[model samples]
Target: MVLGVLGALLVPSLSSPASAAGDATVVVRGTDLPVGGPIELSYVGCARLYERTAEVPQPFVGLGPDQAPAGERSLRYDLAGGTALGSLSYARSMASTTTSGLSVQAPRGAAGVAWVGYQEPADFGTTTYWFGRADVSAPAGAWTSVETTGLTYTWSRYDMATRRAVGGATAAPSTLAAMIAERGDGPGFRTVGFGCDGNRFALDALRVGDATGTTTYDLEGLTTTTVMAARPAPRGTVLTGVLRDGSGEQVVRGTLVLERQVAGGWETVQVVPAEAVDATVTVAPEQTTTYRWRFADRPLAEGSVSEPTTVTVAPGQETSQEPTQQPTRQPAQR
Candidate 1:
């Protein structure tokens, strides 16, 4: 449970409930210089188990950021880590893409997967990023921009600005280009990776670009906003997520939403139960209240607004309402 690039879970993971089989991972280490082309990866696991790992997968050939890179590569699908605080995403080529099940809903259930990885075609070969886990090369931090609306998908954690994509089904953009060649290893060829490469995120396969759009890519509402942390819940305690569609599968009741950060800012109220790939949401914060959790209103993207979750309700419970000073209308001093 001790894994880090910057503080990796120190106990936390309880405020009430919402972490069932919460095995998470998002890897991508380094390398790709002087190779060929085509190798992408993307992280943030479990988005309904990456549409159940491709419903019609199998395809190849597109390498050649020049040559030395190669072609015909495809390991494909895996991603499920939604309930965001950070998930920046990059990649627009082909092969490997996972974010399995995308299950997120913590208020006190705590959280996991606050990822970062970058490799912008530093030559070619090495490229990685994972979901259930696998893929490597590229880790320095800095780069964020997104959009994949329907359920949600918006980000800006890396700070580079631009985040929007919670869900947009229709999928086939090769699972968002294998979720940015695993996780931001840009270029326009094909060689995405994980596993043997030590790409960090411990995923399986996230292959990108599949092409199959008649009209369905509606992953909800996609969004990406940054802040970090959110752990202060009580009440009925439910804040879960897990959706799948556009070729991958698993959608069930599908509707998801929790987006709460109350008072000082951010609020989407609640309307959850996208169907539960492992979902829950019934938080109870009364006093000092402050929240940062996502999958907001459900569609797909819910990337930032954690690191400030501060619910505190007990001893009788039910009193959180104070903070309604919007009056001051005594004009004219004449």
Candidate 2:
């Protein structure tokens, strides 16, 4: 079934985190955190029964806990790990045990993956787990994996911005790099973790890393029409327009380019920062002109031009002529 494939791809047997190319990897070893550390864990729906531990559960080995994959400590989750269905409660109950200081930058052709090792007893039944960037939403049944009575490592590659899977689950490093070159350009920090529907599980050795590649997201139809504030105005009028992305969502950051229809072609007039929903600029054109806005090209989004708008400038007022001379002559005669 597609669900089974997705689960197998999203969740693999425990393995070591992939190494970063040129020191670009960020890792969070479970043993590094203090025991009984304060963490924020939330359960899906209204079910709020869960617990966590940061110690080696030697006694729980019979119940499916395993030694830390890389260090002296491993994070343990018990009580209701596999009780919930993957379709209803996948990662709905999870925690942010530590801060991942991974900074994703836009316009930089970058791609990365998050990996974690977990151990579950054979009796835990079918439980799903996932680790990736925080904002990522794994498809229902994507993270389901049947945990055997031992430790295994699983990893999921993400496009970074959309957090969608890059290639299939358990994608090879080269495949991940190529996928990044094709689509993983949006920027965001990475995260890793394990989750279950009420089965006991232990997780350790979280890691994220990136590589450089020339790839950009296709945002061809993601742009909306440019909305101008005023159509006809004086030569020295301020022209304003709002720039949005492929989904018609206003871009709050980055650069919006203003272009004018010149004698032969379109010429860029100004490159303004997208600081708000709308961007404004003063234009004193010598004649009527056609103008448009576009986003500066970035890794995650391609540069797109908005619909052009023509602004009509009123002609200069005609100078008053002979009336002044006639009035002066009449005054002299009086």
Candidate 3:
């Protein structure tokens, strides 16, 4: 009989899937999005994962400008180890002001919010040029997660050419609920998004709702790659594996299961904790056996498995190698 002493397996996790540049824009209906357009929209840049803040450690988008001079009129989001992308835009019916909120991490002076749509009884005719600077700030070194439907902002009549308020700002800040009620039966939102030229900030878990239901958009997606290797050692065999994200960065934390092939199907050999990026095991197998590593599905990351690894042993070689550590046999679990 032989025992395998395995080290804890360490693998990181992502919040959700990612939407990269050049990919098809994502769209959702019943939310009053633009006709035949994306639910997640960006012009100066695209949306990508950002992990600089503890409050928003998930795959959130960081909005800012590209390589432009200060005060340049740009809408962008900066991606880690990548170029600056554009601001984010979502289609929503301003008419439905049931509830709305978003998680934001911003620095001082970050112009992190906006709303563009229609307004009635305006000096300027109804050309759908209503822009509100919802510049909500966050506490120092913290992220803000607050309901916004009842929040207030002083809207200004927008000018298409200047992309700024045309006339004096409204008398006082008005809540979305009030704005919707005042608009009456006017056309709702043309587009709602985040970005003030030259102001860099981060956002996550954006939520909006109407009479129907609420929808939270978190940019939601990511892909993973895992690999396994087997080599001859003083013991019978040494098995090792690692898991990584799409950018080839090693995953930070998770549990990986060591699986072995049996007559019925693959069976669990042991549970490996990912305290580190790599997982290793020393096994003195009686015969040649095939093994692999598996990561189960998590809240933010998808499930994945490593390529199969095979360890070959000669008849007398299995028990001949000296042991490096005391072998603690772990009972296989289903």
Candidate 4:
């Protein structure tokens, strides 16, 4: 079932089969969306997966000033070279799932992509359902606003185990209640993503709402640091360094990749798991060396690289004390 995002709240009518009793409408306007906050974004590449909690003005490959829709800021995606998918979503925290809706503005010149509605299953698996798709075509450089309701059983049934489409039908919603039903106890709607074949698009004013007071999922920010105790140390001396977050918090999860400056570029030398936040490492160098750390991305934080920390290894020196020869034995023999 699909629900509309109009400002006016509508009561569920008994005349339609899709609309059940005790159904009420809730709306989240585009202007109400948060700015510079955490957003649940997932990007699937042909070869790998990129998922993280990102802030506003997220980076994309082909996005420019003209591509931004008529809004303060938008979620921009640039897809090229292969099939890619990017999505933003929110799931209800309550025991039951609530029907939510979203509105996105896309540029007219965009092609080979469509806005999609999806449902998240209750099972602790990564499977999701694509219930519907909307073609967002507009004039060159113009913006087209497309809105969709939360999806229900009206969409196709997908088999998670086989990763194939089972048997189900896709139809438009006829009743308001059916679209707003919180199928929380069962597999229900959760997130929305774009299905595209190499295209660039912008999304703005994405608002999610339900009958109960549920806030939209916002993206969070992360920080990283790289430090060394001594820059110039004696040859063969072990250089020690520490990694931390912006708030001086230790990051004990994910992988920290250690890299060294090479002739042309940086080369990875070590891949360490972040078992603690105040993680430290020791590196012994034969000559002058430059090092840095690359923090892996987490579900709620974006990955980052630390600034290069150069350590100079000074020449070795002999101690003042010298070894004594067997002078006494030589004198006795003479």
Candidate 5:
């Protein structure tokens, strides 16, 4: 895997041209190029990155007609739609403050980017280069990530109103998995749903405009659902919330549900069916609990749930919420 801020150019072979030219001389060409989109960055490196750039740099080629050795990996193309090259920036942050700037031809899109830097698989010295489509435009927002190989980039359509990233950075499959170590790809970019991964993150508040953003994924690392039977002696032993109608009638056997934030995203932890009285949720004690649940999917949207309830099991507390506390035996005085 070659790491780099700028995508190296590609070599023109008998089957491939030096550039992808089209009838429209508008600049970046090709339907694949994300036009009027945001900016995204990724890193890729190999032996070739260290190579000194002469007056001009060579372009990296993609999987060509020529095949590599059976065991070796082939150099594939890394590009945005219309063969858009990446936009790079460097910055520093401290005490929650950030200072940053970008270095590229076009501030946002491919308007100024003319080259894509490519390196040999594993070996950076074996590099190639390819110019981008002339019509390449500028990116709106920027998303950048650095890896062992190089820095990754993402340019997106910025929601000028909320000042958040709504569009996605075109990323490789490996990139997604690496972002969420233990996550699996499901429906709606479910692999790395809305969350932070110490990278240029695309954040949103889950609005109706963001149809592609609202992803549904199964949460991992649930460990176990410890049960704490309810008891009358203790006002409450099992963590729970009451469900009722506008009239305030005891909603017996209605439903209970749990949502958990994991792997840089939120997912359903538990879902109690309708007509189920209270719910007995099991979880290890932790801080900063952020989750949401659906009560009465029936649309009445009646009762409001208790703000994400958190519990801290003391040192010797019984797993089950018993009415009385167990006797504590002090260690023998040394």
Candidate 6:
């Protein structure tokens, strides 16, 4: 189940992308990129996040392939549609503020963006809103890149007099280049955000370009899986486990807990530090036991657990009389 968000603040839907308040209401840190940059992904409406899983595919080519071997995870939002609507958005905070508030910048022709599903462009300020939408650039399950140099989009400006967005009058369809030309730049483009209001989709590799340079944000979470070296071996058989990151690379940081299934829940058997890229451990059980690795949550990576691997002791194998080393008993850390 997806983590539930409080409040039922209704915003404009996809049909009227530029009618009122923007989608993102709860702004929080999602995850950090490998490039040492923070990606603050805000969830809009009833959006539910589905992290690293084989069911949903990531947008990148060599990353999250839509086939077998689940690739890297994508920042996905699954909307139930009808009354339950959802979207994913990101905003650049003002450079001078201490908080993560939105920033206001002058319109620039160098501004460009890319998404996977329905895109909604929003401009937020104090009692000021400007919403716009363009033709669907990409299909349902693909990535689309748009250079704001010459792209024309239908825009709707908010009218304080009537307390609503006035379309076909004060605001008309305009291109990104034309907006910058008319405004002539200088702190008017406050709070620029883009998102999708589709049923189920993902957003990844957000490359936003400006006059200075372009930064690509690869939004993802950590993933872990474990396997037993020998199954159905003798009572003294050794068990080993391997750990990896989201990109299928060996995990070289943090600690992993070795858990064994108990009557109530899983119990921590050993606390192993991931000194090397792939963490390996050896354990010998007297009877058949099921085990898995549990990775704790960190600032850069969310917590994850591996599939269960049960090792059955050979029925007629001669049992060793030597006593096994006692494992330190403790609860599984988050």
How many residue pairs clash per model?
Answer: 157, 18, 22, 11, 76, 0
- For 1-334, candidate 5 gives per-residue lDDT tens digits of 1122332222221111101222111111111122222222223221122222221212221111122211111112223222222322211100110111122211132322222222112322333211111111223333221111112322222222332334552234232223223232111110001111111112111101121121111101101121223222343334444555533444433554555556876555555543445554444423434444435322112334445543445566544432123223321111
Over 4 Å off, model 6: 1-39, 42-63, 66-71, 82-130, 146-150, 159-163, 166-169, 188-198, 223-334
Q: Which of the numbered candidates is closest to the native, going by highest TM-score?
A: 3
RMSD of each: 23.1, 21.2, 15.3, 17.0, 23.4, 14.7
Lowest lDDT block of 10, candidate 2: 325-334
lDDT of 6 by residue, 233-287 (tens): 3445455556666556655465667778989999777766654744455556567
Give candidate 5 regions above 4 Å deviation. Answer: 1-237, 250-253, 262-265, 273-276, 285-293, 299-303, 312-334
For each candidate in turn, the TM-score is 0.18, 0.32, 0.45, 0.36, 0.20, 0.39
Please report how far candidate 2 places residue 201 from its true position, in Å: 26
Candidate 1 has an lDDT of 0.28
Model 5 worst lDDT run, 10 consecutive residues? 187-196
Task: Give the per-residue lDDT digits (tens) of candidate 3, residues 41-143.
Answer: 4222112112112221113311222221111111123333221222232233345435455554445433333443444544234343454545444453345
Per-residue error (Å), model 4, residue 53 = 23
The alpha-carbon lDDT assigned to residue 285 of candidate 4 equals: 61
How accurate locally, in lDDT, is each candidate?
0.28, 0.33, 0.45, 0.39, 0.26, 0.39
Q: Give the TM-score of candidate 3.
A: 0.45
* Candidate 5 TM-score over all chains jointly: 0.20
- Preferred candidate (TM-score higher): 1 or 4: 4
Residue 150, candidate 2: C-alpha displacement in angstroms: 15
Clashes by residue pair, model 6: none
Rank the models by TM-score, top first. Answer: 3, 6, 4, 2, 5, 1
lDDT of 2 at 135: 15
